[model samples]
Target chain A: MIKDITLGQYFPGKSFVHKLDPRMKIILLTFFIVFIFAARNFVSLGIMAAAVFAVICISGVSPKMYFKSIKAIIFIVLFTACLNLFYGTGDPLWQWRFLKITQSGINTAIFIAVRIIALVLISAVLTYTTSPTDLTDGIERLLKPLSVFHIQVHEIAMMMTIALRFIPTLLEETDKIMSAQKARGADFESGNFITRLKALIPILVPLFVSAFRRAFDLAMAMESRCYHGGEGRTRMRVLKYSKKDYLALGASCLIFAGVIICSIYLPATVRTGM
Target chain B: MKFIEVKNVVFAYDAAEEGEEPKTVLKDISFEIEKGSFVALLGHNGSGKSTLAKMFNGILEPESGDIVVNGLNTKEESTILDVRKSVGLVLQNPDNQLVASIVEEDVAFGPENLGIPPEQIRQRVDSALKSVDMYEFRAHAPHKLSGGQKQRVAIAGIIAMEPECIVLDEPTAMLDPQGRKEVMDTVIKLNREKKITIILITHYMDEAVQADRVIVLDDGRIIRDGAPKKVFSEVEFLKCHSLDVPQATELAYRLSSSGMKIEGTPLNETECISAVIKALS
Candidate 1:
């Protein structure tokens, strides 16, 4: 059951989106995020939604996965949208003691809900298409400029790689340790809040001890392979942007510009509670 | 010529508590491993075999002796990289040694660290995977692989660096019998075909019997060192040190003690069968 936790879930594919350079994908994702926020009226929001939908279709990941991602944050989305419903001040339709739903309240609630859903779906496109390693590599390259200030960018990237590599291993170990503790009659399920927290100590102690041991062995193994640091080190998988990446970047920028222009020209149908 | 020379190596770990005596792991240990030879180091737990394996790759510096790998003294800070490049050390646990999520990426880790160009690293990674017969699983996640497959990938990671010698410290200790066999076959093939020197530290006498030479350690000191046949022939001495010889040697030793005469010690089953049959005839 614990194995089902899909952190940074990526579906491997030969789709155009998947094949784009990860750095370009990250940049395109940033533009899409800005475009979503820049959207002021229904016209601009609809256009941004259309652009996101097109990219989602191109990503080749099933719509089910995107829905699943949205389902995870459905509570927060609904809660915030509900709070925005009563704050709108235009054309009150229904009145309560301290809460009044206006004509624009419904409009504002729909806008906020749609925006949050669009944000989740669009971000899902980025993660669904890019592998974790590629994403980290892209981030490392993007942050490479920080190294000039003695930021140890390479060290951070290495830590990320190792952490990603060990996630599954540590998860499996946790499962095993939990089972061992259960077999030894350690009750974890029936305890109260504080007792449940205390029950975790037995599992956490062994897990930490094993993690430290694994870390020591890994350091020695890396050293034996002559890993001194990132200095003068070359990467096996080089990130090179292709024509498709440039094309994708151009398209995202154009879409953002269009969204901004539409937001400026269109009459505000929905009150944006900024 | 010797690929690795350990001269009177002495190593000890500082006491964990105050007023406690230091724990000496290895003492006056000396041995020479020839180029392109398969050597097995045999010892029980706490015999310092793993410590000696680390010393080969300059992972742990000797306290009072010298270890020279490929004519580079490991004690020299500047030559440590060169020393490691020549003698790659594979640890006991396969899970801990793999640094990358994917098999091929992990193999490329060594060459990448050495600053090999991307194209060459790719070629090295592919060929190294092929050598270990793990090329088909290049895209497979390491955690998804079996213990034997992971160990082979670990070996490929070392091979990608093109190390002249590899010191494996009980690599199959955590594996099943099948996995142990797989690693042994890989190590033997690498030594015979690739001309890479192999020093395997294992407690399995059967595994040691396959090696060209066997060195037995007892309580931080080398008790015996010679060809496998010669060392296994000294069954009484090995047993006294709490070490085991091959099953065949043990059986022959038992027969000899039971008032039956066995001419030579057999290191494997077939030889033991032949010796027993000859005696019966």
Candidate 2:
């Protein structure tokens, strides 16, 4: 049901991975993603996967949940694997009248699939440990240097926080309107494509009206509270880097360097014509 | 000093088309609410009770006349924030007014907007939640809460702003009977303990009976203003305006008509019981 749809979901924990500064986690996540794409061969891919698995374990989140997070992209993973298997040009290992699978094709398919899985798992690890508010706080702090260019970092962060705050409210409103319309015998299900779409109008119109009303009320309330675009605003929980964050950052940097070296020095698999 | 003063205020919604008569919602409304007083506004639908409440905080400016709060004119744009800060407004629908997912964060919203330092904001939020007895649910999502709990949280949000007066526009309208009683008790407790002025706009006669003074509105005009007993005593006038006195008051009026002597009008069940017992003695 709708209750199970967790938005910006973060699992709370007290592990070293969870305790690291959010800013450092964000930076490390970005570095991890870049290095994921930089991975050229199986040796580098193995190193990337190992590093992601270690973090995931240290974070204390079950591996099943991490895979479940990537469930939505299962189709993309399979589709890319299929594309790599057939489109890769090399000596054919298996052949039919018009279809062929080469030695290079098998290697390419495994490489692409592992890369996609590794990329997704690493990103999930970052979100799994970092709460949405902390993520925004970290981003705002990281982007503080951009303020010299007159960028409104705090405003953007506040906007994000507000947006996160309203998601549940909006969801609840949508549910209410849907139920109200249903009570009036407005059919939302069991209809043709166009009929079902037309039925949505009753639910949608009221939802939009209520949303706009809430937005206006919230804006007025914010103004009354004297919010004037985040100038001279001080935070309650200021982001301060700790020793744990420094150590995590150092470890991530080492992993990044190690992956690059492995991709260059490690022996890559070779395929000869069948 | 009067915490809120309305002087000959007139307000209207602009007509849908040009050259058409505007819909006058409040016609020459005037009232003064002293600090720490509880005033209830009672009327049928379209009685302009809500319009008057909005005007108190400058949410809707008067078309003519002035509204002064703590000696500051609400018409002055510069003092509008000060006026709003002095008087908090809570709307009927608890769902619409709450802007935060978490209870504590919603309570912190008003003070946070005031740019109070984070530490002070935390204290205000905690105290506001404690005042409403919602401190335990500080981290819980508001949508999962019951109607009465959400309404109380909404009140807590307003209380966190630390306003001198709190104007509620039919806050219990959407709640069940139990929820209504919970909300009313919370309002009464805040007025009693915090010494905050209360301007309650409601249609429920039972609720009006608990206020220090009741102002009845009819078609954007104040038809009656006095204590609940005095106002309900004019049963004929109230009925003419498509309203009714509380059941106990009506029963007492019937008993008095049937050759029984009652010293005063009974606005509630206990009062009626006491009057009946005294009359028998």
Candidate 3:
């Protein structure tokens, strides 16, 4: 069941979106998120949704993946939409004991739901197209200014890279430990909550021991490779903006400006009610 | 043309508790590795072979003596990186050694650490992968690879650094038979084709037999050091030191001891077969 997780998974593709520089992609995503929240009337939200759909199509990732991401957060979408349903101040569309649904509430509920879905889909597009190492590298380069404050940006990136590299290894180790424990007649399937928690002790102990051992081995290996912090280190896969990245960045800026303009000037017929 | 020289080196780990004595791992070890030599270090667990391996690349400091790699003293802090650069170390566990998720990226790590330019690192990564015969899997995730493949990638990571010597600490200890053969083949190829000095620490007698020279360590001291034939022929001496000789050598020794007129000891399967045939005829 743990193996089925699609969160933060990268689907390799030859799409232009996948070819865009990761730093540029991250910048474009930031612009997108700002515009998504800044959107006011339905016209602006519609434009934002259309923009997200266009990127998702261009990303070449199956629509099913976006749906999977949305599905993972379905509970949050429903809960927030329901809470917004009764809080808007407008003409009552329905009335019942403690619950009065307004026209504005209906609009707000739909607006929030669509907004949430757009957020989920656009972010999914970023992760789906970019590899994890590229994503971390993009983040590290983007956050380079933080080093002025002694934030250790490179160290953070190094830690992130190592963590990602070890995730699958650790997961495999966990699976092996669980199986080993199971072979020794340790039951993890049937028990009360506390008892189940107690049953995890056997697996956890060995997993921790092995993780520490791996960490030591990795440290020694890193030293042997002359890894003396991030100072004087050069990257093989350096992030550089290409013509396509500039074009994509420009296109994103235009769309964000268009959303803001449409929200201020468009007719208020389908306005977002909150 | 000595690539690495160890002069009476000794190493010990600190005491685990305040009242306990520090445990010595390597005791007054001295050796010289010529350029392009293939030397196998043989010892059982805790016999200081691993400790001696670390000393070659300055990963561990000797408690009393000195180790010089290509004339750079390992004791100096400034030359430590240079020492490591000249002598790449391939560790036993392949899974723990790879730093990058992707195979090529992992191979590029050593070069990147040395601050090589991006283009040079790319070329090195490619060539290193090709040398290990893993170039096709350059973009594949390391975790998904088989044990032998992962070990090759680990070796590629070391090879990309362009080190003159490589010291592997029982690299096949965690691998299966096939994985062991794969790693052994790669190591031998590197030694013969690349002319890189190889110091292989292993307990496997067959692997030791394949080396140009075998140095046997027992209880933190060298017991035998010579060519494989010269070393393994003393089967009784090796057995007395709690080590095993190659199967063929043991059989030949037993046969000769049982009063069969075997002309000489055999160190491998082919030699053993010939020896037996000659004895029977």
**Best by the DockQ measure:** 1
Question: Candidates 2 and 3: which is better by DockQ?
Answer: 3
lDDT of each: 0.91, 0.84, 0.91
TM per prediction = 0.97, 0.90, 0.96
Candidate with more favorable, higher lDDT: 2 or 3: 3
- For A69-150, candidate 2 gives per-residue lDDT tens digits of 7897889989988977886677888888868998778887888888888888888988888888788879999999999999
Q: After superposition, how far is residue B256 of candidate 3 from its true place, in Å?
A: 0.6
Candidate 3, superposed: residue stretches over 4 Å from native: A1-7, A266-274
Q: lDDT, candidate 3, residue A204?
A: 89
Candidate 3 lDDT over residue span A86-196, tens digit each:
886767788898789988787888888999899989999999999998999899999999999999999999999999999888888888888889999999989899999
Q: Per-prediction DockQ, in order?
A: 0.90, 0.44, 0.88
Error of 1 at B228 (Å): 1.0
Greater lDDT among 1 and 2 belongs to 1
In model 1, the clashing pairs are none
* Model 2 ranges with Cα > 4 A deviation: A89-100, A136-163, A176-186, A220-229, A232-235, A263-274, B17-19
Please give, for residues B1-281, the per-residue lDDT of candidate 2 as tens digits.
67788889899999999999999999998888889999999999888988887778787889999999999998998888788888888888787777666778778777766668888888888899999888999988887899999999999998988999999999999999999999999999999999999999999888999999999999989999999889999998999999878999989988998989886999999999999999989
CA-RMSD of model 1: 1.5
- Give the winner by TM-score: 1 or 2: 1
